[model samples]
Target: MFYWLLKYVVLGPVLKCLFRPDVTGLEHVPATGPVILACNHLSFSDSIFTPLIVKRKVTFVAKAEYFTGKGIKGWLMRQFFVGTGTIPVDRSGGKAARAALDTQLRVLLAGSIAGIYPEGTRSPDGRLYRGKTGVARLALESGAPVVPVALLNTDEIQPTGKLIPKIKRVRLRFGAPLDFCRYSGSVGDRFVERAVTDEIMYELMTLTGREYVDVYAASLKTSVEAPRPAAGAFEPLEDRAR
Candidate 1:
């Protein structure tokens, strides 16, 4: 009830007037039944704009922190996310992965759209990173078609660490639903999981035309701290002690 109220009655009208988002391939999304909208995670705003444009409610597995923040602002944020079909789940470890999958299955079984970001986290760069196998697992388990969604230019509107979004036109492109019926009953198989995830990422690369990076986006933080050059290694050392 709150989801519909916020979407149609309150916030929806305001967002539509501001972004004027250009959406393509709306017909690709199934008008009824369970469907998994697998989208690229770009910005915090991606969570907002994607659901706003889609006709159906998209249940995204949001980080647990958003729901557990402190004080009034936190309370408001929690309400906003909850109203938009955002489910809270800890993404810190493998067990949390299973929990998230279970949550998505329940949503799909109930005949609702499950929105997932296979990349697990937002891209540090614009390049598309390798997706996690959790989405593939959800699709195979629920027998829902994976619809690849490319949310274009959302990062530009509200980038990382910025509170307010700039006024800009954004676009959303939905590709045809991918059926993994051939891979049925292959759940928990590492090889099959990787294949399914790669295939989805491949289609996303083609649809979005962004550079493909085979590593996880979370590793970017580690890369920053990776073994720095020892004190100006590039500089000439005392002219080789001539």
Candidate 2:
């Protein structure tokens, strides 16, 4: 299998030697079974490093554009993502959301780990942003436990537009798995979805110790001005938890 070969034999050894990543709470990840790894989106390297560090394969859904680029660079990019088992989702149509969910559900239902970034997009700043509810939807639909993962200092290694990552120490922290069986059969309920997403974001905030912004990260990246937040828009996770 190309996945195992790349992970254990080819790329894994090189990455381990280069990053020397310090990971903690790895025991929280279930050794086997369907599990959802809901991690905060930092750098593009988050995709590469997290999978390399985790023992099991983590299937992630990436933007379709990454797989449809032109030229030799595009070919290499497509090959890398495809080789690593990344699914490409065209986030353009009204059905895009459902398609991505379905893809992830299939992976989870097959007793595999599905890695998702609930924030929808990477944080424009280093601060943590509000998470989207798709992660909660996946958990409820697939009956899988959600593990909150925090990737620290990855943005520094590869900032938003940086092609190559600078050699730096990377850190990952995995929190205890969150069981949502109490909300079984509540997959499409918006209120319940929001609650679950907020809970996951809170855990990520605590783990990364980053300032929590109540705004969606993608909105801030767009040219359209993001609406101003209220007086207490940014707050410490401890204070916000109250």
Candidate 3:
């Protein structure tokens, strides 16, 4: 009830008229059944825009911080996300991964589309990063097909740290559903999972045309913290001494 109300009444008309997003390959999405919408996350609005264009109800695992903020704006944001059928997920590693996957598995088991960003977080540099194996695990465990969705130019409208979005057109390209029925999970045969994950990311790369990085999105944080020489610093002690 609330989903329809928001989609048809509140936001649907406005968003449709404003951004006028070009959605392609929507027919590739199964009319009904459990499936995974694996997408490349570009901006905060990726969550909102993707669902708006799709005809069926698509649920995503949103960051828990969006639900647990302070004050009135936070309250409204939480309500909106909840109304849209998003599940709050803790981004912490290990135990949190298990818990979040538990929720996603339940959603898939219930025969609904579970939207996931295989890269696990928004692309800080707009390049597709290596996907985590969790997406493959869910698809394999749930026996659901994976659909690769590429969102284009959404970041141009609303980038990270920008409170308001600029009026700009966006494009959403949905690739054909990827079938991974060939590989059976066997003892010590973890390569299947890696192969499945790599296949999905490769399709996403082709659709989005972004440079592929072999590193996981989470590892980029460490890259930022690694030591860097100061600007214009000499490369060697001899040069500094001179």
**Highest lDDT model number:** 2
**Residue lDDT tens for model 1, 8-41:** 9999998899988888898999989999999988
Candidate 2 regions with alpha-carbon error over 4 angstroms = 224-242
**Each candidate: RMSD:** 9.4, 4.8, 8.7
lDDT of 2 at 106: 98
Off by over 4 Å in 1: 225-242
Q: What is the lDDT ranking, best to worst? A: 2, 1, 3
List the candidates' TM-scores in order. Answer: 0.91, 0.91, 0.89
Better of 2 and 3 by TM-score: 2
Model 1: weakest 10-residue lDDT segment is 227-236
Model 2 worst lDDT run, 10 consecutive residues:
227-236
Q: What local lDDT score does residue 145 receive in model 2, on the 0 to 100 scale?
A: 99
Report the C-alpha lDDT of model 2 over 1-242, residue by residue, as the tens digit: 98888899988999999999889999999999999999998788888988998899999988898999999999988988898999888766359877988999999999999999999888777778999899999999999999999987787778778898999878789999999999999978999999999999999999888888898887787855444333234433553575
The predicted structure with the larger lDDT, 2 or 3, is 2
Which residue pairs in model 3 clash with each other? Answer: none
Q: Residue by residue across 75-146, what tens digits does model 3's lDDT show?
A: 988988998999888888788877888888898899989999999988766777899888988888888899
Question: Which regions of candidate 3 deviate over 4 angstroms?
Answer: 186-189, 225-242
Tell me how far the alpha carbon of residue 221 in candidate 2 is from the true structure, in angstroms, after superposition: 1.2
